[model samples]
Target: MDTIIIEGGSTRLKGQVTIEGAKNAVLPLLAATILPQEGKTLLRNVPILSDVFTMNNVVKGLNIALEFNQEKKEILVDATGDILDEAPYEYVSQMRASIVVLGPILARQGHAKVSMPGGCSIGSRPIDLHLKGLELMGAKISQVGGDITATAKKLKGANIYMDFPSVGATQNLMMAATLADGVTVIENAAREPEIVDLAVLLNKMGADVKGAGTETLIITGVERLHGAEHDVVQDRIEAGTFMIAAAMTSGDVLIKDAIWEHNRPLLAKLTEMGVEATEEADGIRIKSDLTKLKPVTVKTLPHPGFPTDMQAQFTALMAVVNGESTMIETVFENRFQHLEEMRRMGLHSEILRDTAIIHGGQDLQGAPVMSTDLRASAALILTGMVAKGQTKVTKLNHLDRGYYQFHEKLKALGAKIERVSEVEHV
Candidate 1:
């Protein structure tokens, strides 16, 4: 087991951090590469996180040959020949994004056998929306044992309106609809920048997709899609995490390679809380004054809204604020699992239904805490930064799945943190 130990420094952190590519965006975009017929698809600015490696393994399991340059951080996915259509349970159980292969496989091969995916214990992220949308698009889907088998001799596009604009479902259906016959329209689609990023790649691959970054998406079926090179969009989650970290430590940090437009909601909230934020052409700069920290209300929503992934990190920021703040998590039921661990770190938080009421102003004294999920691990580390005593965060593997070089980046920001293999017996 890996653990992160943080010694309270009391010093304000000040530095610059380069935001990595969006993990949520990159995974699905990688899965979409399965649709390309010829030429090696080059993806640059990819984040080297555990989840990315897991997705890469899943892609490899499908027998799609890939050449990755670790130093350059580029992956060349060559999906030329007859690719494997089955995504075994072994790979899918590791990450939910593995289910994304269902659409691309069905689109290109006319059949797919994929395992139901499993990911963070945050909540029940059902794939019904994905299956239902594919069913609407003329795919015959069935469950055999623990796997989902979908077959579409020839997919004909139709209207797919989701009850909620699920990002996973939107990406799946968009890829599946690419090779579909006729026109496919997705109503109430996710407006996340990742969706647009995938659309941009698909268009470059010869698919006609329009109305991205909006509620409605229209895709015209193309017979074949050729491979194209594309650079992934910068991760807004990474940028938001750095922003919250800076705020928690009352630091000044510049996040380069971040898209300011993609982080409007978080930026707005951070600005409201008295965090000095400036948007530049390249990225955004965030500086926090400990004296001005204040409580604020945040409700998690879908794309173009407050992301659920950032909830835990923001909660840590609110822990040291001057007043009470409310965080409503509308995306996942178990997202507040971090609050229990936060309490162990001297945070005053109460969970009522989906809302967490945080009574701030307490000088957090760090204690041993366990990470429950990816974002939760980040929140714990952020809490450790401002806490008064030594903090040990166990189960750091979850943190590795998302953030690249967690402690290294914090160390560069002058944080007193270290990743040690030795575990302290409580």
Candidate 2:
């Protein structure tokens, strides 16, 4: 087992850190590779993370020849040859994002059978919206055993509406609508920047998709799609995590290439806590040397709202603030599992249903904590930045699923951290 060991105390994070491409965008783009019938798709700015590897393997398992050049940070996918229809449990079970490939597979091969996917146990992320959207587009879907099989003689477009603006459902349905006949309109679609990134790639691949960064999406079906080159967007969640860490420690850090627009809500929240975030020519520069931070209320919502992903990190910030803060998580249930772990470190917080009342002004002493999910792992590490004594974070595999070189980056910013490996038992 591997753990991130942190010697926590007052530390200043000063320097510029460049972020990798967005993990949320690249996974769906990797799935989008299956839509192209010929030519090679070149993806630029791909993040070097464990989940990306898992999704790449899932793509390759379907007979798509993939070559990843780490130094170049590019993935060359040639899904031009004979494609397979089944995505086995071996690969799909490792990451829930693999469910995305099912839509692309059915769009290209006309039939697909994929094993149920498994990922972070944050909440129940059902694919019913995806299935329902496909069914509206004339695809017959059914659940047999542990697999979902979808088939259509020829998929035709239709008008569909989502109860919630789910990022995964929008990506899957949008990709599936590429080779579909006629036109497909998705109402209440996800307006995340990653969705816009996918739309850019799909359009480059010869699919007519519009209104990507808006509430509605219009995709006109094409006979077939060809490979294209695209650049992935920056990881807003990863950057936001670093931004919060900087603010929590009252440090100065310049996050390079971080899109200010994508992280407006987080920056606004930081500003409310008396943190100074200045938009520079290259990126956003954050400075925080406050003796005390003001408490602020946060409500997690879809894009253009405070993101659910940043809730955990923000809660850590509220732990040592001037007063009590309230946080309501509207996106995922059971996300408060990390709060129980926080209590072990001497933080006080009350959880009622989906809302948490965090009492600040408590001195923190480090303790061993286990990560519950990918974002929870980040939350724990952020808390460790200001905690007294040594903090050891286990279940690093969760952290690795998203952020690339997380410890190395923090270390570069002058944090006392290390990656330790335990002896293997035979």
List TM-score per model, in order: 0.98, 0.98
Clashing pairs in 2: none
- In order of listing, the candidates' clash counts read 0, 0
| TM-score of model number 2 | 0.98
What lDDT does the true structure give each of the candidates? Answer: 0.90, 0.92
lDDT of 2 at 129: 93
How many times do residue backbones clash in model 2?
A: 0
Residue-level lDDT tens digits of model 2 in 1-426 = 798989897767888788999999999999999999989999999999999999989988898899999999999999999988998678899888889998899999999999989998988989999999999988899898999999997889999999999999999999999999999999999999999999999999999999999999999999999999999999999999989888888889999999999999999999988999999999899999657679999999999899998898889989878699999999999899989999999999999999999998789889999999999899999888888998999999999999999999999999999888876311
TM-score attained by model 1 = 0.98
- Worst window of 10 by summed lDDT in candidate 2: 417-426
The CA lDDT at 265 in model 2 is 93
User: Which residue runs of candidate 2 sit more than 4 Å off their true CA positions?
Assistant: 424-426
Please, what are the lDDT tens digits per residue for candidate 1 over residues 1-426? Answer: 878889874957787888788898889989988998887799998989888888888888888998778788898999998789897677688998888989999999999999878889999999999999999999999998889999999899899999999999999999999999999999999999999999999999999999999999999999999989999898889889998998888898888867788889999999999999998776788999978877899999997789898999999889889899999999999999999998887888889999999999887888999999999999999899888889999988899989999899989999998887764543
* Candidate whose lDDT is highest: 2
